[model samples]
Target: MRGNRGAHRGSPDSGSVTDVVVVGGGQAGLAVGYHLRRQGLDFVILDAEAGPGGAWQHMWASLRLFSPADHSSLPGRLMPIQSGHTYPDAAHVVDYLADYEKRYDLPVQHGTRAEAVHRDGDRLLVEADSGAWRAKAVISAAGTWSRPFVPALPGRGVFAGRQLHTVNYRRPADFAGQRVIVVGGGNSGAQIAADLALDGDVDVTWTTQRPPRFLADDIDGRALFDAATARRRALDAGRDDTGGVASLGDIVAVPPVREARDSGRLKASPMFERLDRDGVRWADGTRASADAVIWCTGFRPALTHLAPLGLRGRRGHITTVGTRAADEPRLHLLGYGDWTGPASATLIGVGRPARDAAREIADLLDA
Candidate 1:
């Protein structure tokens, strides 16, 4: 029976075929899987993680969702949180994802890293570490966790201080008593700088290309998600969506960040001109000494696996109309960012696009 199933599914060894293959088992992937399951389509979710939680497993120890637990849930299930836990922590998110997968019985192959995706005649070939899957359609929901973007600043190599990206950041204790520079203007930078500067034990400097933007104190992730949805809907209806509004870049006023602000520790400095042996150098020839630098510079999409398809645009992303790849009709991308779908990277934002993408795939298959 095992051999028969393998043969039927077109295992990399046997060249079997499946109906669809969704890459990455993160929030985006899981959302898409839910839709596909509801459509009664044959599909499999390929995740590289050894266990559940997708990229949440790699988040810093103190990371917390900016949205409430109920608002941050994936499709079909609300993320369960303990009583009195308003904002779910990283562990809660991970556990919720694991339970979601189990609850839906989504065909997710854990630890199956998709190395490459290429065309195999009319079908798409997903080359994974465990094996290969041939599918009529492919949804690349692999979010950006694998590709941390560190800008190529001048003299970066000469910096003697330790440099780490947000992906490598785990805890504040790691930089205890050290003078650290937190780079970038995003929430990660704010939260991390606050974490390290807590109790005034660590000297932390925040740097940004532009002054960071903070949302109104009353606003949070739920409001931001709603705004993004409205913008997407307006644009989809051929209406102008250029009206001024708070963007996703605006930092949410989370408790820790608020506390940091009240304590006068959430200050930021203009970006330095370059990195020096000891620290960062300004254009005015002044240099600040630093023991380490943490880059909260965000990530690029993990699309190397799709390179063989030749579908990516000059922006290093595939041009997509909604979730469908413009160049490769059978290929779709979800949850990378707004380009794939509005606010698709967030847990609250992925569902609509995933559902639409699944429906399109089902329609195509039917045709």
Candidate 2:
């Protein structure tokens, strides 16, 4: 509906405007950009990062994808794989994302952080660090990296030991020779626990609300993604197809985890009742002197930018029909996970929702 206004970087006082403003430069935003490019929509992608490779650049050094490069790619291009590399590390993913942005010539403005989104008559106003953007529609793909969620426990603040979330964890070397507790039942907790246990000198204990479930050795992220896709398709077709499928939450027994299991270091304890001044206290009144705690809890969607619109529900999520916001048709949310779209948070899974959102926005503007 709007003509192309070639890329430029400056303050919002310049009156920068577009038909669509995609509020992130990560996989979901990039995927949506690809479709918008095909639709010939005038749009700009805003990224807060200093350069390419959105949040992937912040991942832990030892972290690796559970799937191969090809299976973990975005919509248009295949993520190139190096010879003999089964699972790509964070650096590889970062490189691929950077290349994807360049290859598509996506109009992405770096260092532009969206602070708020509100309706201004027929247009949506995005207030960002660089300035303001008045867009016909706004796609909020800001993602969950900024909103790490750590559940509260009794005496949490009284514990003398150091506490950090997975967001701050980079490598196992930092906890060397320390008695550490890794908390969470998810894959992150399993991976981090295994990594820390690899160091013979580090005493690592794992705590989970429930026992962690590990998928069979043959199953990895690829299989999990495929199964999720199939289940979604089946549901759309009015059939239940998840009878025997393993959830994405189940841990894939990557090499390190398998090694940890064989070494009997993969064991996890029931979650401690409370944190004590010196350590953690169990239900049976037993206390372990932990030097540090690592919370592998997941993240909440980073939707603060949309608060001004007053669209959030009780769960802090805006209700969406597919990727389009239920309350605000001109506003769409991407990569906020299952509520927005199935597997929307993963690299390979975001493409479908991105495509759908782009098409929906295109239709709305064309009308």
List TM-score per model, in order.
0.95, 0.95
lDDT string for model 2 (86-163, tens) is 999999999999999999899888888999998899999999987899989999999998899998999899999899
Stretches of candidate 2 exceeding 4 Å from the true structure: 5-11, 241-249
Model 1, span 19-132: residue lDDT tens: 789899999999998988788788878899988889999999888998899899888898776467788899889888989988888778888899999898888988998878
Q: Predicted candidate 2: what Cα RMSD to the true structure? A: 1.8
The positional error of residue 55 in candidate 2, measured at the CA in angstroms, is 1.5
Instruction: Please give the clash total of every predicted structure, in order.
Output: 5, 0
Candidate 1 lowest-lDDT run of ten: 1-10
The true-versus-predicted C-alpha distance at residue 363 of model 2, in Å, is 1.0
Please list all clashing residue pairs in model 1, or write none if there are none: 9-16, 9-17, 10-15, 10-16, 10-17
